[model samples]
Target: MNAATPLPTASARDTTAFLLDVLIPTAAKGPLMRRPRVEALAERLNLDRRAVTRMQKLEEKYPGGPLLLRLPIRKQAVVLLPEHLHAVLAGSPEPFSPASSEKRGALAHFQPRNVLISTGGERTARRALQEQALDTNSPVHRLASSFLPVVYEEADALLASIGDGDGATTDVLDWDLFITSWLRIIRRVIFGDGARDDNQLTDMLARLRKDANWSALKPQRRKTRDEFLRRVQSRINTAAPGSLASVMRGISEQDPAAPRDQVPQWLFAFDTSGTSAFRALALLSAHDEAAKKAREEIDADTTGGRNLPFLRATVLETVRLWPNTPMILRQTTTEVTWDNGTMPAKCGLLIFAPYFHRDGRRLPQADTFDPGIWLQDDVVDVGAREDWGLVPFSAGPASCPGRHLVLLLTSALLARLLQDTSFTLEGASRLSPSRPLPGSLDNFSLRFSPRPR
Candidate 1:
């Protein structure tokens, strides 16, 4: 049965070949789990969008090939299709462990037991505490609401800093205005307004900008992280009453085992929002009708005191193109079963959301930016879905706890920004001959200015 299945690679000497020779097949030629290639696989996803185009090509080239594929190691199989994602993500955590070895190792120095990386009894407890800490009740909802002013202020500041005439020619990302301002929002969200001036928190965030090798080179990395976490933990009570920090502290008291430094994980979790927001900048600038419609919806919300569904739809569309984390890896503690296949114990699984969201056959207008696709025959419409098919924030028990909060924040910020300012893509960025996504995100440039009154 295994001989009938082919993976993305066929090199005889590759580790993938060895896995095939040594391990039993998961039904057909589906992905093989060997050692661990989580980090390497994540790197490919992070470094280039074109990598996704290539992976899609592989699946198309091999119609009967395994939906999952082994890279070089045995520990991970990139789950290429939607059904595979449902198998790993929708299943119970007992079989598909929530803690991926890659996440645990990568975040080891920053946080030893963040909810995302914790395992065993501690993992379950941490997850519970993490949820309580982010509960959508009054306090947590208030925390999210409180940040709107910050978003308004920062969005205005970003527009102000967009510079006039010649300066508008500058790269949008090069100035780092949005990055810095966005981090401030994440900081304020987690640590409260008192964190506005905390240099140590700022420094810790700076460390996250570099690669693992770069961090490994810094001799004081561990000490720096330890000191930062300790200081933050001690100051939880100092956070403003309605902020995420205070909520985390309250939960910590209830569950003595809950780590005080949990807020940092929340801070890190939204880092992808920064990128997603920027992509919105690029996309909205290109689609004037969409931008105009979104602005009108925002205006209506302002007048009618309603939520802006159009803006939310735009955010979902952006995420569909670029999921926060394209490849989510999970390791199996027990044998995991999916339709027609059984993954043995200790197998590592990958969930590729980017591919799933963009699959043309399943999703209407997969490549089209029709936020209207999200419109259901309901009272209110926003183009995102929490279904197994579209798992930007993923689905099931171990899925992201901050999904609601993130969607709320993302839509609100974009709505505010679009209402106040107008953007145009820089000529070079617009004309770049990138193979995949039209304008390369790395060099995307947008000129923001006040809209006509």
Candidate 2:
């Protein structure tokens, strides 16, 4: 297997032309807010595997560790290999910065003051606060034990919404069902028993989410959030036992004085987790064989198997293939060099996950669905998840703190949904017959309800 293409002068020159000609067209498309636009473009290009097809072509032509591409604005160093991922993301601090995420700024549009967008002591403090909140010993972290029951209720709610399974079917986008369920879960997780059914923040966020300049309008959005923040703070002040807002407030006052803003920012993170889980569910529907195996495992481990390895393996594999966002960025604060390329300070490090996850060298059968690799860990073997760092949840200090919660929630949702019901894909969008991986079925309707006992 090829390690990576050695960066060359000729390829650098060609990379410019390739960016202008081929790759940009494959960039994100569709609505700015309601759903992920990358998934939209992936469907358009028939590459729901998200950047996999684009990166495959780049690898063939460029043959290098990292490709230097000239966009309309500036040159970006797109790193698509594992060593470089370890080098820049996990390896160091001074050189690679989080400002690259601030550059994208979609979610940041609505919440600009987010400690997440910037770096230095502010970002560090924010990250530390989040860690404490989700830490094993934290009272807030104890809510994890309730995931399966929550999923069961949410799943049943979805079934009720879809009508009875007795010859009655409702046609709906698969994302619609998944997100509806996730929103219910997140709402309850945040507000607990007093969770408001009406999610007013959704509309304000929708209006704010666009490709245009967002600074001027961020104030308006913040005003909208102000009321919601008050409501949450009130819940905390009232000391609602077991609400996320209350838990976070408790963590803040007693443990460390994490910003009041931390709770909402952390809440916003559920957007990606929810979306990623939805993607896994969509992919699982397409691959009946994998779903069957997962069902068997679910059947076997009924009592206290909190960690369902099969479903976790399947979710990990799906996330590796199609992360919520294909592009991860880091701005260079100082000069760095590796793999025949020079990354100047203040430039960019665009780490594309789809490319690295499918680098062929790290993961054999890189194009298809395979969970045995993750399952192989229990059976004893070095799999892609461990060896190469499959980073849908990302890695290192900046990695998502709720990664474990997401895995558990996703595993529970898939296991419950697939164990009882079978969904049929309908309409123009359909999964490919051969590969059964994520294909161009982004906008399809699904109809499923619980089976009779």
> Each prediction's Cα lDDT score?
0.58, 0.58
Q: Write the per-residue lDDT of candidate 2 for residues 269-376, one digit (tens) a residue.
A: 675566666656655666778767777887887643356777777767767765554556678787667657566667677776766776666667676777676665
| TM-score of each candidate structure, all chains considered together | 0.78, 0.80
The local distance difference test score of model 1 is 0.58
Root-mean-square deviation of every model: 7.1, 5.1
Q: TM-score of predicted model 2?
A: 0.80
Q: State residue 166's C-alpha deviation in candidate 1, in Å.
A: 18
Itemize residue pairs with steric clashes in candidate 1: 30-66, 31-68, 31-69, 33-74, 34-74, 34-75, 35-73, 35-74, 35-75, 374-383
